[model samples]
Target: MALLETLSVLSGVGGLSFGAYQYYRAKSDEKRKQELNDLADELNDLRRDIDGIVETFQSPTTKVDLSHQLDYCTKDVLAYKHETGDNALVKAEKSNGGEKVSNAGQALDLYKNGDTYPRYHLTLESGYTGYESNLVYAVSDHAVYINHLYKTLDKLQERHKGTLEEFSPGLYDGIEGLMDDFVEDTYTNILSHRDGIKVNPDSHNNIEEMGRFLFFYFWHYEGITKELESLSQLSDKIEEARTTILQASY
Candidate 1:
């Protein structure tokens, strides 16, 4: 009878122990689940913060609009110069019996032969030397402005090279080509004219060289105009790229 009673008590103790163990296990599992949930919430919050930061920098509208002011300044310079140069030429030609000299040599010959120098020649020389300061000032201002534009395009290419090419393959190529042409040929010719025989138009060989230089100058001028036009297209493509990237989920 004593053994039977002892066995019953032991059975009851074992059941209580099992029940306590099960309760502890349930509590542990619940705690672990809550921890996992908190970590997931934190991760989601971090992702949202990162997305906001990325949106701020990669916003195409903000970045592209930064260039508008500089672009306008460049446009103004080119337009002013083109207008002044053309008007000066026309006026001078009209004054000289409506016979516009086709080349620099012809103009130089007329100037050298004791003919009152055409107003255009004087105006162009002065204009080339900056309506404000000296020749160096004019060239420097123009070159610096152009270089700013070129550098901006270069950085845009570098930052979005893959995307830009995928979207507009020849865009950067055109910019680079025009820049190369200006640096190698157009800029060199202008510098040569400025430094050499610019003051002395009496030399026939020099005048001929000037004629050739002017031809190339006009060509480069046309190229620059086209380059400026391409900016609008580039702006559009950039906006498209931004929209595409924004819409895609990471």
Candidate 2:
């Protein structure tokens, strides 16, 4: 009877031990699964970041350059008469009682208007001899193009402000300053000045001012080109970071 009781006790202890082992094994498996799920979520987030960087790089904003053309008025008709001996309005009136002249005063009355304006070329540095005007649309689309790039960078900064700041605080600040400068200094001062000169061609001050401003305008062009190249590098860096994170996680 003692032997039978001893055998029963041993069987009970063995069953309890087997139950504890099974419970621990199941818990371990559950923990491992949770860890794997967490890693997958992290990886997905990194992939999304990568996609965002690529999308920004692909944006039309990045394609902006000096290739586009701006149609802008260069000289006022009456103003041109004072600067140059030739009077375009008088000639037009002589031809047909001013029937072809538009109230807007654009010299190129025949050209369809929609963001295009009369083109003018003047050089005060050499001499205040005369002015030339045309309707041909070519390069110097800097104003609107730079504005688009500035806005694009602004959106990108807002989207990844925290990440960018964490990666490189100075760079983040520099980009912020660049956007502001492009709007306030480059776009506002240079482009606006050009427009002012084009519209007020009769003003001697406006003409003279543009002569001096041309130097700065060309200089700004070089600066903007360099900034764009830097921005391209930044985009590549972001992509590289995303790739590194993914590789490390794997």
Candidate 3:
């Protein structure tokens, strides 16, 4: 009878141990699901930013660069990493266990020491003269935002298992390529004054005297208008991609 009691006590302890392990596993699974959801939500927000970029590019007085200028190489758009780790949107864990938090903006800005910043620096106001009135200023943030989206999508691809599998692979590259081409052309046209054509305000060529040869012709970039028309295609591809990501969980 003593042996029976002892056996019963051992069985009860074993059952409790099993229950504790099950609880831990369930909690762990929940955290994983929450983390996946957070990534999906982040991916969606990045996609949405592109729509706004399309509009901003078309406007005449649109100020696309950061309101304040900095040496963008030292502080590119992704520089938000060193800024904060607190995300107010979603909790870091599945449960309200205050352990670690995440912010999408901060995640994108995770590092500054990279090769990408130099290209980003070229998009600043100094990228081209008269950028404020033309495409350089217009393309600055658009480029950064698109770069963020591109890098974010690459990250999600690595993070996830499976339609969400790079639904539109070339879409990111296409938009980025167009922006790059436009920026390149703008520089070539604007900087022609230095070596190719003399448009500098010199003793020979007065500012008012160059009126007939208006720089407005330079802003009429064939590529910008061409890309503008194709914006619909860009929308369709990304909308489909976002749909796939939205349906995904973990």
Candidate 4:
């Protein structure tokens, strides 16, 4: 009987020990699960903060505006009237003709006589030896400018002749003689000056002076932007005419 009672006591003790061990294991598992959840929440908060910073930096808040201006010249007409009376041809009491007739003619005359250039010859007589070098340079420069101007004129004449051949043959024929005369005069002047330079190399101080004169002459003549403007206008007109002809053909 005593043996049976001891055995029952030992079994109860073993059961109590197993129940305590199970409770301790359950508490440890719960603590680990709580730590994992905390880590996951912190990671989500960090990602949200990074996203907000990115959005703030990527926003556009500035704007810009730009503009430009251009200028040009055009002819102006003051008055125009038509008369149906007996004296239909009422001329002006006093008129200076046109700008081209007056100014262009004067310019042509000056150009022909070399008056458009500086009067270095007169300046040379002032006994100013210091300016002799400058005078030589000036003369050389003027000669070069005239030569380039003649070449440019020749080109313009050729273009004018080609255009006349296409559209205004009669006008071309009438102007041909005048153009020939102008060209001949220009050539004669150039050859005479070139020959003069060869004979009077002493008149030029040095090779440097000759070079300076040639450069300045070409620079001035080549600086003529008016021809470029005229060429651009001609190109535009030609394109317009071509387009019109193509459209008509179609």
Clashing residue pairs in all predictions, respectively, total 0, 2, 1, 0
Deviation from native of the Cα of residue 6 in model 1, angstroms? 42
Q: Which candidate do you rate higher for lDDT, 1 or 4?
A: 1
Question: Model 2, which residues run further than 4 Å from truth?
Answer: 1-159, 188-192, 195-250
Per-residue lDDT of model 2, residues 90-115, tens digit only? 10011211122232223222222223
Whose lDDT is higher: candidate 3's or candidate 4's?
3
TM-score of every model? Answer: 0.29, 0.31, 0.42, 0.23
The number of clashing residue pairs in model 3 is 1
Full-model lDDT for every candidate: 0.38, 0.38, 0.43, 0.31
Clashing pairs in 4: none
**Range of the 10 consecutive residues with the lowest summed lDDT in candidate 4:** 69-78
> Residue pairs in steric clash, candidate 2?
71-117, 72-117
Candidate 1 residue-wise lDDT, 135-217, digit = tens: 11111122223334444454455554554455446755664554444344433333334322222222225433433333333
Sequence-dependent TM-score of model 3: 0.42
Residue 3 lDDT in candidate 4: 93
Ranking by TM-score: 3, 2, 1, 4
Quick one: ranking by lDDT, best first? 3, 2, 1, 4
Best lDDT goes to which candidate?
3
